[model samples]
Target chain A: MKKNHSGVRIGEVTLKWFIALHLSLIVNSLAGVASKMAGKQKFLSFRFCICYGMVLVITFAFALAWQQVLKHMSLTFAFTNKPITIIWGLIWGVLVFHEHVTWKMILGSAVILLGIMVGVSGDSGSDGSSLPPEGGKGDV
Target chain B: MFEGLGRYIAVWIVSVFISSIAQVMLKMEANREHASKLKEYMNPMVVSAYFIFFLSTFLTMYALKYVPLTYSPIIEPMSYIFVPVIGVLLLKEKISRRRLIGMGIMIAGIVIFSM
Candidate 1:
């Protein structure tokens, strides 16, 4: 049972680290915005390149941050928070895309989020570290 | 504003399928033995898997041109469903009851949300 200098346990992290991880998750979600913008541009156009390039940069950054976050936080915690991205997606759609929000969409998103939470918890419960990184999922 | 919406949905589904295959490829790579730790990550399989992911992302972006950003995330979990089913068939993996229930819930949610 080796403890880090921060007195954190193997799976425990400080609140600051937790917030940092969420920020990274939000950053990852922002790539979806860029993706949508890229989709609107002509393929291989300057604006398209810029938007897709931004997506790549954000993905790389999120991947790096995810590794760092995993070191400080347990996979269980990280996986649990992953579904929060769905909420973020909804928020971005409404605020950025100006898509109308219907009660049905909200309810459906809630159910999907709950299912992922259940499914991931079951998989990680047996062996947390054995699974591959799930960064690609829910990414635009 | 929604012309040829069916084709756009098809493109999104194809992207989801590609991404799911990439996920399975990653799992396959994880289950393999490499010469060294570095080789484990930098090998052909891992590299190709990521390349496939890139293709998927491009398709997703293309689909976004026609599909709503909000709707894309709703159906995005289709890949998650595909992975487990593919795993069960190709990898001979077992599905736990809890996992089954979760999948059911997700399907229900997708139905409700998109309906």
Candidate 2:
């Protein structure tokens, strides 16, 4: 049980890593957008392939950025913070798909976000938030 | 509900649930020792987990046809609730009070979002 505290303040150690995490999440949610576009196309069709291919591309980019973020931050913090993508997802829905956003939906998302924050707050008792030992292998 | 896209919605939720199971399966497999690094991921458990993930990705694409991107994110968070419950039921893991509250709040959100 160790708290690898370099004493700079936890959670988003640097603005650079914070940007990296948010960027990865933003790009990753676009994979859902591409998948949705793929769904609209006929299966095995060229358009479907193109859209799904875009999903793969976006996911690959996200994976690279995510690795950098994980190298800096903790997985528990990263996972719990992923709901930010929901906001991006909502924006993409309205902008790309012309989907309607109602007050109920906003309220519901708010509650979920609040609940997740509560859960994260409670997760601090253990050393679960720390990264694995430096140079630990099998990163794949 | 969902303008009779119930079947696709069902498929999407099931895929999410299955993928979370795959995560657990991978964790369980990783906890075990393997003769070699290649054998670690090449073994039946890990291979099956990846296969499940692959199939679920396709299922997600299929389900996205009827499920709008807007509602998809709302529903997708359900996996946050799924993983811990699976851990408790299968691995006999204990739950913390905050997580239970979090799940309860998320359930409330889901019900509200659905209605």
TM-score for each of the candidates = 0.88, 0.86
Task: Compute DockQ for each candidate against the true complex.
Answer: 0.58, 0.48
- Native contacts recovered by candidate 2, as a share? 0.47
Q: How close is candidate 2 to the true structure, as a TM-score?
A: 0.86
Instruction: Please list the Cα RMSD from the true structure of every candidate, rounded to 1 decimal place.
Output: 3.9, 5.4
Candidate 1 TM-score, C-alpha based: 0.88
lDDT of candidate 1 at residue A65, scale 0 to 100: 91
lDDT of 2 by residue, A1-140 (tens): 22254533345556556677778788888888898999899998999999988877876777777778878876667766666777777789899999998888877877877676566556653544111111101011
Local distance difference test, each candidate = 0.78, 0.71
Q: Interface RMSD for each candidate model?
A: 2.2, 5.5
Best by TM-score: 1
Looking at model 2, give its docking quality level: acceptable
Backbone collision count in every prediction?
0, 0
Cα error, residue B112 of model 2, in Å, equals 2.2
The candidate 2 chain A region of ten consecutive residues with least summed lDDT is A131-140
Clashing pairs in 1: none
User: Can you tell me which runs of candidate 2 are displaced by over 4 Å?
Assistant: A1-12, A125-140, B1-3
